[model samples]
Target: MNTISAKYKKDFNMDKSIEEKLVIRNKRFQSRLMLGTGKYRNIKEAVESIEKSEASIITVAVRKIEYLKKIGKSNLIDFLDWNKLWLLPNTAGCQTAEEAVRLATLGIEMNKKLGQLENNFVKLEVISDSKYLLPDPIGTLKAAEYLVKRNFTVLPYIYPDPILAKQLEEIGCHTIMPLGSPIGSGQGLQNFYNIKVIIENTKVPIIVDAGIGQASEANAAMEIGASGILLNTAIAKSGQPKLMAEAMKLSVISGRKCYTSGIMTKQIQGQASSPYYGIPKLQ
Candidate 1:
């Protein structure tokens, strides 16, 4: 077992050497795993988990922060260190294009307060469906167009639809975040085929967002050529958020390395690792 483990470790190290940084909208990110600042039991746990994840880009729901401040409760921004982390403000709870645009505008102000003067990154989400939490395509497209016109680096979250992804890219979205499954369901890549198509067709980054419940799921998405991942519940709702975050970080790195190293093609029949012709005539 030790020998087998050592062999994998050596191979992974070689693969890691050729791994490239995840670039989105001209900004380079060393870690392809982007974490959300929600669902944790406490702020301390959330901060610790973010540290363990080693994710440079952190997504925060602008409405939640605003509500917390309005209620006189501590908000996520107060705890995060702006110097080390880049904020990806999201319009999570907005159900309409107008509402999403409004929240995105507020997010820009929030970023300005965080000392991100020129930062305009916004994760645009427009969902009217409460039960499934599925993004509304028409609303999302409308909001994305408005945001893009205002020069915001929009990263819209949507279902794994190849056509919509191309439209978003054409409209100047920095990245396309396709749901792996329903939000927080942990179903893990239910739309794997469509996502692959999106990755193949689009020129922008394809980030697998939501429904990734474990490290293996995260790895699977990255291995299939996803540019990055944005997950919250899998880490925040885990038994040990910190440990799970670390697992996710390593899994993203391993998956990216595998993709960059060029994974072996699938074969229908089993083949011997060693050449079969080297043996002498034997009884």
Candidate 2:
């Protein structure tokens, strides 16, 4: 490690080789992973984790904060500190189509006041029941079609079914996010085969959101051709959140490299990688 580091440093600066460039939906990013802003200890800690994660898109909810609301800053947004992150306000906690649309519109209005949003698109979360808070596929489909008509780049979160993914794309969504498990479950890649099918079939970006317990899980998702991942509790709840964030970033990169390189095909018959008789080659 020391020898390689010294040699690389002598040839070219080591610090400059670390940072990577990422792009999504024509927006440039230094990282591919997107982090959710809920469940953080505080706004400061949230920002710290985001920085450490190197996530390009930061998912936030459109709910109002009463304290900030009384002072005419109802959304509790801090645009000044979030210059590097793309604001992806989600329609979280919305049980109905009307409610989700209103929240999406409100997010646009609030962020417009901040005056520097990179884009006007939003990440839509249309959850029906309050218990598990799982997404309503029917409601999500309806909302996505509507949002597309409204010229918004709708990124809809849904179950791991491919029919829903195709339906969302037909309805004009920019991306489809399927949960690996339930929200905040951290079970990690329970539906890997279906996810693989989705990646093989779909044209739009397929992101594996939720249920990623650790960096390895995220890496596996990337290796299977997922466009991106959304994580919050896994990092925020960890003892060393910032360190975990960096580890996740590297995992995604390595996984992506393997994905592009193409994995070796599996076989039913027994096959050996090593030569059976290495000394026979000398003859």
Candidate 3:
């Protein structure tokens, strides 16, 4: 298995020479992996994992941060270095378009407090389902349209629906984030076909968010032409969050390299790698 994998990689020339940048609106990022500051054992572990992941963009749940601030408690923002990381405040707990729009305003305030005075990036999520945690397309679209009109860089999290993805893009959304599966389910790209279609059809970045449980899954997402990935549970719930974070970072890079190098076409029958015309006759 190792030899075959090595040979395949060599044939594909999946090296680290390709230079690709993930551009969302005016912002450009070298690292395509985005991490979330939640579900960790503690703030220290979360910080360490994020550092190890080397993800330049980190998402924070706006509602949670607001709650912490109201209670006079330090939140994840207090520890993160804003100069090194860009805050992507998310509307995690919002169930309605109004609620999501309200939380997004709070996120702008939070960014200003963190010294990101000009930051307007938001991860729009309007989810009412507690069991599946699936995003509501109508609510998300409403919130996205409102936020975009307000000059916010909207990155709406939605189910892997190709049509909806294009709709958000048409409305001036910076990026379209389609879930791999249910949030925190770690099912790993259950909606692979839909996501692939979105990537093929969309002009903006297509980030695969949620349901990625391992580094390999992250790699697979990037390999399938996803512009980036936003994940949390896979690293936070791992026994060694820091190590897993690093693994995910490498996986994203490896996958991107593979994608740029060009993946081989699938074949039904095996073809001899060595030239059959040059074979010596055996007695």
Tens digit per residue, CA lDDT, model 1, 170-217? 999989999999999989999999999999999899999999999999
Error of 1 at 268 (Å): 2.2
Q: What is the alpha-carbon lDDT of model 1 when measured against the actual structure? A: 0.92
Q: Residue-wise lDDT of candidate 2 within 68-185, one digit each (tens)?
A: 5767752325622556667777888889888889888877765565564547768888998677667999899888888889888788888888888988888888788999888888
Report lDDT per candidate.
0.92, 0.79, 0.93
Clashes of 1: 0
State residue 149's C-alpha deviation in candidate 3, in Å: 1.0
Candidate 3 regions exceeding 4 Å error are: 1-17
Question: TM-score, each model?
Answer: 0.93, 0.84, 0.92
lDDT of 1 at 274: 95
Segments of candidate 2 deviating more than 4 angstroms:
1-23, 64-76, 269-283
